[model samples]
Target: MAVNQESLLKKYISKDQEKQTGQAPRRGPGGGPGGRNRGMNATGKPKAAKASVKRLFSYIGNDKYKLIIVLICLLASTVSSLGGSYLLRPIVNNLVAPDTSVQEKISGLLSGILLMVAIYVVGVLASYGQSRFMLKISQNALQRIREDLFNKLQRLPVSYFDTNSHGELMSRFTNDVDVIGEMMNTTIVQVFSGVISLIGTLALMLYTNVILALVVIISVPLFAKAGGAIANRSRKLYKSQQAALGGVNGYIEETVTGQKVVKVFNHEDISIEEFQVLSDHLQKSQMNAQFFGGIMGPVMGNMSQISYAVTAMIGGILCVLGKFDIGGLTIFTNYSRQFSRPINEISMQMNVIFSALAGAERVFDVMDQEPEAADGENAVKDGVMDGQVTLSDVTFSYVPGKVILNHISCYAKPGQKIAFVGSTGAGKTTITNLINRFYDIDSGQILIGGRDIRDYSRSFLRQNVAMVLQDTHLFTGTVMENIRYGRMDATDEEVKEAAKLASAHTFIKRLKYGYDTMLEGAGANLSQGQRQLINIARAAVSKAPILILDEATSSVDTRTERHIERGMDRLMKERTTFVIAHRLSTVRNANCIMVLEHGEIIERGTHEELLAMKGRYYNLYTGKAELD
Candidate 1:
């Protein structure tokens, strides 16, 4: 009876659900930086096998010249091996015949032995050539794949990263890509060799004796069935293994980055317990995957032996009846062994092929995601921005049907400082986000210099808008290099100037290596205040027309904040600036202060004007109601 693939898949899913219930969910192994987990769910959707395979071959076709050479070498190597086997028949039937003279027999046998060695040598050389050539081709293809993946990441919107974890994405570069590399190095070449060898052996066997050849052909289906069953089981197991490994990796990344929090909260023991559960899942899944894959070799080997035994029996009966010669029977048996060897080898590789295809499917799925919205044909090409920002009836929600900002209208004239004071989640930072187009508003007209922000190219728009966020991140580099990241073409003198303007030069000069000091893991060696200072210095170097400080000074002390405020006052002198802060003191010098409630602006004016109003702003300023 034919199997119902859909029903089989549903049954597998049900069993997997039961297994998950009996055990904890998987967490990936290892630790590194802070990042979210972006791995697929353990029972995530399976990819279509045929489509994935076809897509995988498209990558292989990238280096067609090398692939063609590899094929030629592989064919040459296979043909030499098969031809050497056929040469055995002539050597046994003629050179060592009973009627031959001793002297002549020795001469013929010596020449034939030399010819076989020559053929074997050629086969060895061709195999080596193909191996080396394939490596180059495979590595080049992998490089393109990695490049495409990373470039795709750059083009992807921030919203994509918001939903995915850093660890999960990292796995695609490591585990999945590694598996594909291994398949290309070993399994793929073996598959080519096995196929060519099987075909040649079949033709030679039939030329020797049709009856015995038919017997070997009969066992092909049995071998295929057995191999197919193991491959199916192994494919499912490997998928779970990959997912479990991703889970373990994600947990490690999160725990390592948050170790300080874990220790402060006295949760080390609980963390270890959780890690153990994830590690256990990975172990079990890997063991099961390997077990199913490992059985294919032995099962195929036994089937080959069975085919060989049946062929030998029929050959012996024919020889006894004087219908076949001893030399021909010997050649026929060898051909029977050669024919099944390829079948067995092909079956053994089915598991690896399936696993690699599954990994490719995962990678392609990420690459296939929709990229960020592109610029319109008429998008601003001149890169001129006046820094006069206006939002008219802007409305947006991170999620649909749940509005965060409703019909919000605001404006920041050129060369003026605008301050936003609101409780948490009151849309202060969201306004700044809209100005840069990190995300587009659902329904709104956000204009910079009277032109809609969407009319400007995203890169050009962002280049003109510099933001200093509450959470500062620094890469592994010298202090000078980190500052230069704001403007790659900035001069050394300019970097020093920006640092001075941010009040960071004093602290940087006190460091052992000064500006040359190398930072690691987002500058873990530096204090939070120091990191924020560097972040501000970076934005200062950009000299963008519009500046946004979203709680930029939140990490500094009152004394430090006072010192930085003086530097910030000078920095904001001629730039259009937007400030978001809970500390009312930070916004006291603003040209205008807007007090927001929920998603609407309830009060708008200078500090004294709001104080005189005796409304929501007055209450917040006086501490009657805290800034939530």
Candidate 2:
């Protein structure tokens, strides 16, 4: 199956922050229906003999008893299969021959034949039941895994996400899990069946003709020797292939996110060319994996043919020596072919089992990752408070050696609107990120309500703080729903009130369906201003005591900015607000203004005081070209 199509086949895959928290499994019909979906890496295949067994039991986890029962049923069916084939000898020799009695002997063998037929029928039913049972087991295992991984994502610090690409994480949820699930539902079942058939065939052959059976077992080592080496080589190859796939996915994610730039700069052709290079690399690895894996069938088939021919010649010689009859030779020949059937199956499936395990390991690697930061035990809900914010001797870095915020200090009393003005990458937004505990400080403490912010649960910290970023993100929902995102339980009237506070209610009502209109993916249908208005309304409804407006009015037209500032005045009046704006004009009325330079607090005071200083802030606000 095309896994990518099914990857987004559900109602709609939420790629952003809509993941449900808690121990409950993710709601889903998951990972699609079958192995037909195509996509892999590694040489030195991890020994699946023991690890897979553990993972299988782990996959079964508490469902071990159920799996044991399934195995018991499989064994019984296997015994029945051997019994049915054994009965064929009597039915062929005694019931069907011209020398046999027309009635008496025929009737006796007929009853045995009927019993054998019944046994085969029951075994067929059991095999089907086992397959369905395993599928359900695999489905639940994958769902639980997806939910756990998502929760881990929530606890991870910003630096963790900063280090990894979104696409790499996505592969863990997509390609990796599917590999494990396919093994559980399909490959494992095949392995079980192949083992039973192989052992039973060898046993029945030995019972019929020992000489022929010994000859067949001789070449078994040859198949094992070749298969084992191919599996080992494939391990490294699969690892390389999966890593290449990650690169392709990362490219797609990065390019799509920057699609506007690509289009404007007419870089589509260049991007495609770059993509082709990665694609060619992936193709080469994939072709190698497929080429080696593909040869297993033909190689095994040839070995099986040689074994069958040898078995026939040996059996003929044994019969000439009066060690076996014609009927026994026929049965021995059938068993010889059966032994080869299982050998061929093992050779082919070994590749799939190894490749799948490698994929599973990559996924588990993500699941095994420790989140950089998480809430402390005994953390409590934040109490409502007058927003008094303070940061002292704060030091932070996205990377260990590169400090983004260095020994910085700031204070904002209750009901004060403190503005941070700087060019991009001057640590304006990083300051706001720290306030929400998106990343913890390397040193010193951030206090809100006169207590260290780290003392509060991360969730509680965020619940008390709100931010309206320059590039506003909106979920796929109605305008009203988007507004209510801050409070899921918010009533329509409450949402309307918040919209009014945002100066967004009037324009929203002008739309055909107004607040009831549903949005498509990422609010793409809405204009930039409309989306920002909704985001502002969301923050308003949140009723958070602390707020950060990062270039909030940058996207609006002059008239809209004037109106939004009026709304902003209503919103920020009673809250401790941090305004990070590139538009110095909009923040001119701030209670205080601070100038930042390279992670340092360069200048500070009220807007008027800074303009009076005629220093860095003065030059920035005046736009009078100043020499560096």
Candidate 3:
């Protein structure tokens, strides 16, 4: 019976619920980055099984020559097995012939046995060859799949990363790709060989005896009907099982990452309760899925046995009537058994095939997302940008109909220090984000070096802009290596100089290995202030013409902040700097300070000038009103 894989997938996979609901999917409690929707929606299923299969084949197609050899081996194995069984007819007839001598019968029996062994040996060798060749083909295809997926991720826009959690994207590389690999390694070959064996067995059965062939054929519908019913139920249960599994995994990841927070808040009991709920759901779904999946094998085997018994009884009656010889009856009965074996194998493998297709669909979904817009045709690819920046009536929004920055204008000439101070969500960071074109302005012109920012290629534009954000991140590498990450080709001496400029040199020398000291887990070995110092050193090494410090010293203590501020004074001397700080004292020496409120710059002047005006900036500076 032919399996309608596309139809079966449709019964399980459905559209993602996000399409219907205008809001993003709910994450775990406390807005932690974990949940079933991290990588894929729990309730939703993969769409377009046929398309996923076709695309996966395109990857497999890279090893077409090896695949062809594997196919030939499969054919050889199937043919050999079928041929060996068919030989039973002649061997039995010769041994039982009424006129044959005893010596002749013995000779015939021994030779037939030897020939059967030889054919079986050939079948074994062919099966081995197919397995060996298929291993290489599957590995090669998976390698390409991983490479493509990673490369596509690199080209995806910043907004993509902003919306999707890192855990979800990582799942494509791990769980999703792993399932695809499993399918390619085993299921594809098994299904193909099973189909071939089924066809070969059916043909031999018909050639042996038409009546027996009809008996097996009549039972085909029973097998198909039973398989379809079981598969229908199994697919739904399996879908739920996968979703529950994702939920359990996501919850575990979230809880573990926030163990410190959980302990501090005395929320361990609540966390345990939440985990129990998820684990219980997973257990129930897994039980149902396994029950249905496991039943397919025994059910098909029982039906096959019933078909074999009825065919055997009919064959015996025909043999007694002299309508069929005993030799023919023996071979036909063997073929009858072989026919249902392939059907059973195929039915059992359908679940695996369905899972792999769903995984492929998820992977393809990521690949199909539109990458960042390409560079403009006439965009500047190479030039030295002067430290001059301007924003003319810039309007912007992260979401449509919800403006975050409206008709804002600003300018900073060479070597000028421009500072932005405002309450949170008042577009202080948004202005700095717009300056580097992290998000393009809705309406306005942002010019750097007297040319529109859009006139320069994104890479070239970003090359001149350096930022030290409030959040510091470090990779698993030595202290020196992390510092040099700012400028890939910077020498060791240059790195140390940058560290000194950021006042991180003193701490580095005190570490056990100085600059060579190893850091891991985002520099968990270092204090938060030390991590921020290293981040500042990284930005110092960049030597970019324009610098942005968004709460760059926020994590440090007052003493450490003083040292960083002194180093930052030297670093800011020859570059145009933009600073966003909550502490009003940090912006006291700015060439110009812009006070922003409700995405609009409400005041602009030096510290004394803003104080003289006695408005929002003055109130914030005097502590008469909080900057919340």
Tell me the TM-score of each prediction against the true structure: 0.91, 0.87, 0.90
Off by over 4 Å in 1: 1-47, 626-628
Candidate 3 residue-wise lDDT, 1-628, digit = tens: 3334343222222222121211333223233422223443322233455567789999989898999999999999999999998888988999878999999988998898899999999999999999999999999999999999999888876656654545445656787788789989998888889989999999988888888899999999999999978877776666556545555555566677788999999889877876666567668877887788778888999999999999999999999999998899998989888999888887777667655665676677778767767889999989798889998999987665668898999999978989999898788887888888777788999999999999899888888888887678999999999999889889999999999988899999999999999998789999988998999899889878899989887877777777777777787787899988898888888999999999999999999999999999989988887535
Specify the highest-TM-score model's number: 1
Best by lDDT: 3
lDDT of 3: 0.81
lDDT of candidates 1 onward, in order: 0.79, 0.74, 0.81
What C-alpha lDDT, on a 0 to 100 scale, does residue 480 get in candidate 1?
99
Ten-residue stretch with the least lDDT total in model 2: 33-42
TM-score of 2: 0.87
Ranking of models by lDDT: 3, 1, 2
Candidate 1 C-alpha lDDT tens digits along 341-431 = 8777866776677567656665765676667788999999675688898989999776556577889888888778899999987888878
- Per-candidate count of clashing residue pairs (backbone under 3 Å): 10, 11, 0
lDDT by residue (tens digit), candidate 2, 120-184: 99889887777777677777777776776788777665645544557756766777666667777
Error of 3 at 483 (Å): 1.3
Q: How close to the true structure is residue 266 of candidate 2, measured as C-alpha lDDT?
A: 89
